[model samples]
Target: MNRLHPLSAVTYAIQYGFLWLWVPIVLVLALGGIFDPISPAWSPIAAPLGFLAGAAYGIAYYYRFEYGITPDTFDVASGVFARRSREIPYGRIQNVDVRQGVLQRLLGLAIVSIETAGGGNTEASLNFVSESEANRLQDQIRRRTAYVKEQRRTKQRSANEGEQQGSQRPTEPDADSSDADRTGAVSGAETDTPSDPTAVPPDRADRTDPDSTPVDGEEPDAERRAYASEPDRQRRQRLFDLQARELLLYSFTSFRPAAVAAVLFVFFLATDPIIDLLVATAQPVGGPQEIGEGTATNYGILTVVSMINGIVITYLLSVAYTFATYYDFELGRTGEDFVYERGLLQRYSGSIPVEKVQSVTVTANPLQRLIGYAGLWVETAGYGPESSGGSQSAVPLAEQSRVHRFTENLTDVETPTFRSPPTMARRRYLVRYSLVAAVIVAAVFGLAQVTALEGWYFAAVVFVAVPPAAHLKYVHIGYFVGENHLVVRSGFWQRRTTVIPYYRIQTVSTRRSIFQRRLGLASLVIDTASSRTFFWGTPTIYDVDLEDAREAHTAGRKRLQSALRERARDDDLGLTVDFT
Candidate 1:
């Protein structure tokens, strides 16, 4: 068992005191005038008292929390009032994340966040540990997990081999059998031939062991065996990396400029009353100018200044966020694991188990697509949709060619050929967007009627832009059913291609809404172990021909079944009896 760095207490105390400081403000607001007489004076002393209490709690926390790493499990003992102990097996660990902020780095400490296949929350977090110790513990757990899996596989093989040998051995007749039983049913002289011990049972010779049954319509053999050779960790290869300049370029390609501009505009609008108050109070050296009513020049100057300020602020903020999030991004590979390190202020280092990766997605915004670059994401099981933020970027940005090359090596499969949906999908998209435009127009008309702003009717022009938007969407939406995986490509602005292996699929569904049915079309939705695309994310191919949807569903379901059968076969190999 190990305790956290002593400095962790300081970290805890600061956090606790900062949180406690909020109590005084809340109390003052909630009590209103009840304690008005003493509140002002006591407010000055509240923070120090809170700090003392926080220090006591921090010390108590230090004593209560303890962690231990055994051969197969990582144990954490915690809880102040009621003791709670948790033990996570090494094999369940999905990723081990090491994080070090500037302060932690200066103090030679790190935070180890262990994520498992269970879900979003970190299974166990060891805060404020020596950086070297964190790395060593992560490595130790990895080695132990691999050893345990290998041991299980070896036992499975031995059991299988024993069954094979037992099945092949000829059964011997009972040694103490009567002379009549010892004699062959056919001829007594032939049965007397040396009293063979390896004689096949006359009745049971035809029976075969159910445990040694064939899989995939074939018997197990060496050629059919799936043998994976572990890689040499000493030679971890650099698979991909993003330079500062490239990262900056990727940031510029973000599709939020309009949204940011709108937000800044709204923010300025909200602060107008405060700005007016400040302007009225401030006495200027030069007297106020005599501005006439409906003067465009004066308002234009103010607007221009505000726009410039907003642009500068938004640009600076965007740059800061980009650099902090993805500075010095690098991806490395060792055996069946991927190592990623990035971030400027709080550096993040983590390892991803390749086997746990459910799918790989290649995405490109319009600007990136024009420049022939795209971003890559790896989705793992139990990672919910874009909302839950479970997916991780494999690479922030790379040329399309490089992305495909890396993806091929990662999945051991070629880039799947994509097929566009039926041409009629163009009409469906046009109808969908046009309907949305009509709704907006109707709302604008109603608002104009209420506000008497008849000019709002011009907003109906929004419909004019819908046709091209619909066309672009139709052009981009496509799907591909590969030999062992399904690929869905969609989105005109941020083009994304999601590749899902059949083994990861949990279900296949084809749905037809009222509009789709009227158009003789249906959507094919493939659900996987990861819920990453279940909601707002594009998880289905929409407006495809009904027949096409059915075909895709059938093909996907068949492939899923085949993959499941393969997994079942593997599980059978691991079903050996264990003797401690």
Candidate 2:
């Protein structure tokens, strides 16, 4: 078995030692000065002792850990006090991801993660390995996985052929047959079945049968021949590379609600100090009454300035985060997998198998829409550390036209014209918004009665804006049912359009809220295997007429069944991967 690079011990030591460093600081704070006098004097030595213990553990782990690739499996063995061994078959391996942090990059090392299907975590991790070795391992695993799949296919085909031949064979001997004819038939059957089960037949020696059992002294070149036959070992085609200008624009346009909340929290915390500072700095130009009015004016101005500053700070922080997370993002495709490499501080490289893709989404916020920019996300079956709820950002920001084209190409379906919900849906939204506005205005009116609040009527502006907001919401919501895909679009602030292939649709149902039912409407929801749907809600066509909703649900189910049958036919012909 192969061992990790020698420098890995340093990385391990740093990680383990940092945990111990906190121990001494906590010990000193907790017991040194309050509980024990001698603890204070000797506490200084605890740091070095902790470091030594961490280093010892790191060295021990390094000696124990070992990993290697066998003919059909990736094996790992590692334990400090207890021994553990694991073997993962190449056929079951879903992804081989490589990541490099600042420290690891400086050390010329990288971390490799092995992920499998069903589990939403890495199955095996190689903490620190040489950069070149990491690449080699990824390539080796890919090749082996393809080889294993091909072998299984070959065996399945052979088994099927054997079954057909057995079913067609005569169960009873033909009494009318001549002795010579019976003898010839017996010889042919004996020839097909080898006397020594492990020996290859002379007639079929040149052809490699993947299902055949290996002979005692089989040549090693047979495995090499199998590897050479796999078609997946090819050059990758570049699909998308994020531009600096696009990244900058994306950062500005990206609206994170959490960032706004964080800014509000900080602003409220600093508001009192800022007001006090402003009041102290103000000069008294006249009598006490005039000075009081001037101070009040200064307080209002200060509050406005502080709010502006908070907004600016929030924007800057959001931009900085976007830069750090998505810098140097690049996407490529190799055979049936889409490969992506991204991040500035901690670089990540991984592949998304095409067969695992559940749906494609195109999103554009108001700002992005105004600038003609949009983002594309691909939802897959399992989850990854870098993915947001099973959705991977394929293109963070790009031209709307380009994003649409890419989506069409990936899913092999044309974008269809969307059908809007009935006019009653718009009326329902208007009524809903008006009711909410009325409640806010009533609340402000009550508050004004107890306090010296002026212009409580300003809160009535929400009623004035209700009509346009409701209309915008209705306009943005629509659904499309195409020949092979179902598309749903909704949201006014961030317009999201999701394209789900029919075969990938896991469920189709209709739901009606009290308000929707009152309006004689229901929502049609389409669910996929993506975990995101569970958390964020399924893609839905909201406030459709009850009859239309039922019709759509039935159509979606029929389409899903038809698409599955087509996919199965294609799989039988070896045209697509059978993820199942």
Candidate 3:
């Protein structure tokens, strides 16, 4: 078993040190003036003891951990107290990702994470390995996975051929047969022979085509060698590269609501401490006295300024984060894999296997739509680096037409002509928005009566905007049933158009809420093996007529079944055999 680089010990020491440091501090605080009256005195020694404990644990862990790559699997053994060992088969590996942070880059170290289908997390992680070792491991695992899959296919094909030949063999003639039976059988065989003079014999048919026939002593994989000899530029197609201007636009448009929430949370947590510090610093040298109205006014002004500052800081941080994560993003396709490299601080390089891709999504927020820009995402099984809902951004920012073209090429489907939901659905949305507006207005009116709230009538503006908002929602909600894929589009704020191929679909369901039922509408939900769809919500044709929803569900199920059957038939006949 190979050990990680020696520098890994320092990384482990830092992690374990922090953890151990917390343990003693917490224990000292909890036990003070309780079980031991002198426990408070132990706080002074806690720091030194914590450091010693952390160092010992870190060293032990480094000594216990071991990992190695085998012919069939990647083996890992770890644990200081309890031994644990795992072997991940090469055939089951979905992705081998390599990442390097700022410190790792300075130290020439990297982290390798291996993911498998349905794992929902990295199956095995090798942390703090040398950069060169990380690259070797990734390439070796990829080659091994391909070799294993090819071997399995070859074995299955050979077994199938043997079974077919055995079934085709004629049964021996009965010993009781008369002489006339033997003579007839011989004549029948002679008649079965081809009579056309130009017909090629069965045994020599393959030899007729030079490309199909191998030269004497030639290798079986000569074609693969020729392919490998091709230039790198010809081997991979560049799909999209994030430009500086586009990246800036994407940073602004990709604002997350969570950032606002985080800012508010931090404000609340720090408000009391900040006020206390200010009060202490502002107190007169003579003595403390009641804060006057002027002082209170100054405090309020400061509070407002702080809030504004927090908002601005949060926005800047969000932009900085986007830049750091996608500074030099590039996406390309090599054979059956989509290779991507990104990151400004911590670089990442990985590939998404084409076979694992479940769907393609084109998304554009209202701002992006106004600017005619959109983003593309490819959803696949399992987890990936920098992925949201198991989706990796293929094109973070691009023109709408470019995004559409890329989506079409990836999915092998044309831009679908979407069918709008029935008019009843629009009426339903209008009623829903009107009710929401009424509720807000009523709440504002009640508050105005109980408190000195100014501009209470401003709440009425919601009612004025309700109609247009409802209309936009209705216009954006649509679905298309293409020949090979189901496309669903929805959301007014961040419109997303998802293309799910029938072959990747796992289940079809119809849901009808009480309101939907009252409106005589239902939703058709299409599920896939992709974890993204499960966590983020399935692709659904929402608020359609009940009959239409049922028809869509049935059609989706039928197409899924037919596609699966065709795939199985191809596999059985070896028509979809993969040599790489």
Candidate 4:
């Protein structure tokens, strides 16, 4: 039995980081000495007592997650006394996921998840376990179901072969094939047996046997042999099954707004500097006395411990928290669609049928670029702005070559390359960004000059630099459509693009800033199932653009509506004609 879920290491790290599960409560007891400054019992008794209790609770709470699957169903049961179990039939299983967090990657644990056909809730969850086991389980379940299907298919094929061969009885499997089917069940078994699992070719040896004879009403031996796969064909099939296993857990990536939002958490921490500045100015103390006292050193100390320490810890923990919270990631492919299951606490999952995919996009972040990795996004319809917010996705990071190869392999179509507008076309965008930055900087500079916030602090105002930042941000913008996919790429250091399908677009909306209006350009807003916005009517988060923005915005929704109406109209006309 595997002792841990793949997610075990990551979850425990999170428990300690986010909840301070390991930091002993005795730290508080030790603080009593500081406040009292006279207490002597704090060390020998209070500290140990507090530490012991805290450590106990921490250890107990750390192991509270359980997840796995049995032969019949996949499930996860966790929590102390009050446990929850979610199980789904093997056939109904739509997706099974294996995920590795930063810590889990190091510890080599993986969390396995199963998604059913339709759900607005988490159907099953496994907290942590061995990565290999989770993978094996995933393969096992997929195989069990697929193998059963193949078995039925093989049986059907045999029957068809029987019909084609005109055989009275189906062919019996050899001992080796049966054993192989038992071990490989779903996928591998298909190979050991033949692709046409059902057909039976009558043995010619029986015709020569002294005691063997065909039963009455049975077909001729020649007809029975006609339905079976030739020796060469069977060999080819075995090789194909072995080869296809590489595509088993097929890799996936989508434009992750959740990740982007989480990354933008930097802005949240950056706000504290502004607050500190305000507090410093508003304080009446430290006027002239600061020159004689250690106020400068005190500020430096505060910067080192309070500002730097808090910010660094917050940033590190934020990344961990975000991964645990949002990228509770999963990816799997079904009949004609690719499904992505992600998010923490409250899970969110979205699936995109390949036919509906509007585009495939590739992008890179500075950190990722250095290592030759990039982010990928898929844009689709029925969930994007046309309905309310345009549906788009950013997903699994991958190497450029891996993405290219997977695209071609999965779709069975040569990958299509989409080209964007000329770089010069974006000159106006720089102007727009420059003007916006200028307005902000000028206002801040004006306020500083008028308020005397600092004496001749003219040099410090260089922080108002905007032209370079805005220009860099503009250079990264690219938008294009390829095959059935619509793609858009933007962002400066961390480039990103979204590939949304035409039909997954639930809604589409457009927004325009007054400045953009002045330039005779409108912004196109695209939104998807970003959890932050799943309400009715307008979407909460969308991209704003200024092109054929308005018309292109509703293109998907209008097309769908027209198709549905036409379908309805066609059905009604048939009813009125009453040809039957």
Candidate 5:
């Protein structure tokens, strides 16, 4: 058993007691009373009082909170008045995360967060522990958890063997009796010869047979055979690794629209302030005539300077953001998990269980494609694409050839040959895109009518692009159903190929909207534990022929069921972890 660091009092006060102390300060300020200590006039006096209060609360909390690790369970006792104690068994623990901010690092301390299976919140958090202690504790917990799981599996195997031998014991008795009689005759032992084998006395026939007995406490041949037939554990293998040059290349290739937009927004915000400063400085030196005479030229020069500054600012911000987020990206395979590590300022170390991964995606934007590189993203059981807010990429950038190798490691399936949707589906895509273009044109025309808008005709020019864009989109929308995986490739500019294992899929359905039905086309929708595609509509194989859609659905469903059966067998053998 151990207590947190002495400085934990300060951390706890800031973390838990800040609200309590600040509320009174806010109330005093709002009331506007000179007598109130936290009022603006008397704020100097309020600081000491708040500090004393925080110190008291922190000390009390430090004394009440305690944590300890037993052989199999991690126990935590915490409370100021109404104490609560929790015990988390090692077997159920899923993640042991350690984090340290600047202040914590300066104090040589870290926070250890323990998360368990099927729980949304952390099971326990030990704050302000020694950094080295946190790391040691995390390692010990993981090692013990693995050891416990192995012991449970061994017990299960032994119990199963016992049940199997018990079932076979009844049939073996008769054969053993005949063998024993033969042995007795050969050894010249006197034995009663019954007219019928069935007429033998039950007590006499119940004697143990030497032939059926295990020698030297060894296992039976049948049990040995069963053990031999069990599947081998997954071997550790390297898939893809990012080097220094590759990581630098990845920074340039990783183009995020959201980030670019943010830079542009910052540029826009800065332009007004800078232009106002220039105008303000010039206003004092110039009369109305002089100002009017040079106003157009001054505005031109300011516009040019601002444009240059904005571009430079955007470039620097983009580079800084990329470097900060993915400074030393690395992905590798361990026995049962794919370990992803990166970050310069705030280090991250996440080990994603291979079996928990639901789907993988190999994607390339225009810039990355030009560099002959692609990125990988994984969707796991709990982390869906929509909710995976950080960089979802497992391999931030790798050569196209390396992508297939990484996928094979994660999926245990080969890169599939994609088959495009029926050519007739192009009409649906074109119609949908044209309708969108028409809506935009209608909005522009309405704007022209309401306001003095110029170049309303220019908006109509967007119709020229609709056909080509729709055609490319149609060409890219393809699906492949492999022996054990489903691959879907889509997108016109930013191409993506998603590979999902059959076992990950939960449902398969063929859908037909009114328009799709009219065109004799249907969508094949495969739902997995976590859907990774970022589409407004369903993540599906859209606008395929009706019969093909049915076939795809049937094939996917059959494979899913087969995978479920295999998983069930693994469960029975105690090979799979029980997350719940």
Candidate 6:
């Protein structure tokens, strides 16, 4: 090891302590098969190996760990044997997220997370830096990114002499002085050498200039200036005030449903054991009703009833958990980025650069259908197979108009006309499929025997309920292809709509199952990364609610087919997409 930082020693120590706690587990395995025998051959060999294994954890974290901010990259290098480095260009950084778990908070430390497009693997964490240092680092990164952007711009404009010029951009902070200071600084640099501003190396200038201004009217220089800006701490404080607007936007979005689902799922899983316990206790002893257990006594119907009771309790618990975690979710706009932050306990924050967004999807469930609530998701790129969520959503659910404006404002593109799915034409498919379901329900009622009122009654119930429900889901299934993007919206009870950026599409496949194939209908699956509309970021939704809906949505879908297919499709349709 070259050397360890002062804190590396503590970090290593903690790693070792945690590793040592695994001793019992290792000991158990050893005793089960090998550790017990103290043979001359085994004792000497095993002892050293075991000691080394135990010691590796601490040495490993220390040796593998690294963190630094390079001029072009903010990087974290770690991983013992595999050796991984997450280095993101200052330009690639989308945002900075900071958090402090209870332990870190107690230690007065903050963990800084750097967010980048397609750079999720890094979830790169700082061991624990002082809270103030963490903030400073974040601010510093913003500064460096701005400075670097400036350097690139200057390079672009200075062309043939770029190499010599960019190499000398100033390193000093932007001198935020009055006109007097600006003039003085320019003159001061000149006094030192008297070189023309254009002649000065861009790199040297960026390195030295705290407040560097771009030359007037040059395109490349203007672009960089557009992206980079000095930090204004005051604006950071205003972020809180914008939180409410974000929350309002998030309320109707699919994020709310997804969050609700996730929390409920966690709680449902957690409470299952308790429900099982309750059911076990509720059962009667002995008799014909009892289950086989240590007790020989039989119980009455109480066991089954208790289980039902338990299920009820578990469901309620899950609902409660949903309410708790996503109680006040927020998703809003800040400058050119969309911010998403939520959670009552385990809070999470994320952002999307307006340019990185690929598409959006909207959906709804039966409940949402009644309430005029819907969910929306946005898709972007740089996320692939290993991504945590396949579907990247923006606002999971929102009122229709709000969702439109959200998409419109975020993209700075016109909201293409919204087309509700064909209610009757598509209803044909749902009705046909639901007919099968109605038959099944009728069969069940037939076996139960009352077959008179119950017969017509059950069949009528099925015939009426199934198609209506299915139609609701189908009729709402529609998609829209806009200037630069595409959207697919569907769902009756639990409605969902997804918007995907054409730029981010990886693949689009049209599939047909045996049933659908027989029906001459097919479902189109658009594969993408974590999308705001995707449930848990999963890119696929099942069973086409509309046979022709896919056809109607083909323009955007074809964009993802193949290089040739995309070109041909766009050519045929004459789509003029502006790539930023």
Candidate 2 structure lDDT: 0.75
- lDDT (Cα atoms) of all candidates against the true structure: 0.68, 0.75, 0.75, 0.46, 0.65, 0.52
lDDT per residue, candidate 1, 360-407, as tens digits? Answer: 788888888898899888776654222264577888888888887766
- Per-residue alpha-carbon lDDT of candidate 6 for residues 1-580, written as tens digits (9 for 90 to 100): 1223446547666666556655645555566475445333444445445545645666677767777655567767877768887777877775666565556656666667776666444456666666555654565565565555445544443443344457787676566668787888766643453232222243533442323433454453353344344322323312222234334433433223344455457557888775455545664432242244433223334545655664555555555554444445555543344555555544444455544555555555555555565555555555422145434445545565665565555454455565553344355566676778777776776755752223345455555666566765566666555665666666554555565556456666777667665555556666654433243344443455454546644665555554334433332211111111
Best by lDDT: 2
Tens digit of lDDT per residue, candidate 5, span 1-580? 5688888887777755554566556656877664544447655566557766776777889988888756657889998878899999876876676776667767788888786654335688888788766755655465555555555644655556456557874543455468768677645522222122112122221111112344456454543343234311122244456787877787766554556689667658897776565555444444122324555445445546556655666666666667766777665544345555566666555455545566778888877888888877776554321233211567778787777676775566666787887777898888888999999999989977986566788898989988898888898899998987889888757787888778878888888999998989998887766533343123588888898888888898898889777654443321111110
Q: Single out the weakest 10-residue window by summed lDDT for candidate 2.
A: 571-580
The better-scoring model by lDDT among 4 and 5 is: 5
Candidate 5: pairs in clash: none
- Candidate 2 residue pairs that clash: none
For model 1, the superposed segments whose C-alpha errors exceed 4 Å read 20-47, 153-235, 255-316, 383-387, 443-458, 533-538, 567-580
Q: TM-score per candidate, in order? A: 0.75, 0.77, 0.79, 0.44, 0.73, 0.60
RMSD (Cα, Å) of model 3: 10.1
Candidate 6 vs. true structure, TM-score = 0.60
Model 3 misplacement above 4 A:
22-39, 153-237, 272-312, 533-535, 571-580
Model 2 C-alpha lDDT per residue in residues 1-580, reported as the tens digit of each score: 7788998777677777766766775777678668756466666777777777777777788889999776657889998999899999877887899999998888789999998876567889998898767776776676566555555545655566556677895677678998899999767754452132212233333233222345555654564355345423246567789999998999888955567777668668997775554444433322123234644445455546556666777888888778877899888766456778888889888887676778888999899999999998877777655444577788899999999888877777676899999999999989999999999999999988996666899999889899998999999999988888899999978789998989888888889998887789999888888776333557889999999899888888998898887665444321122111
Collision count for each candidate, in order: 2, 0, 0, 73, 0, 89
Better of 2 and 6 by lDDT: 2
Candidate 4 lDDT by residue in tens digits, 1-580: 1235434544555454435432334464556657877355544555455545544444554465544444445555555457665666655664456665666657766666665544323466556656555554554454444434445545655455445457565577676677666567645533455432222122432331222344454454432343232321222111011011121111211132444455447547787675465345433433222323445434434344445444444555555554543343545443234545554443443444343344445566666666666644444433331123223343355556765454444333334353443343355656666677666667767766775334334534444555566566655655443333345566656565555444334556666666656555554555543322242222211223455565566565675465445433332111110001
- Cα lDDT of candidate 4 equals 0.46
Ranking by lDDT: 2, 3, 1, 5, 6, 4
Which whole-number lDDT from 0 to 100 does residue 18 have in model 2?
Answer: 68
Model 5 RMSD in angstroms:
12.7
* Candidate number of the best TM-score: 3
Residue 571 local lDDT, model 2:
43
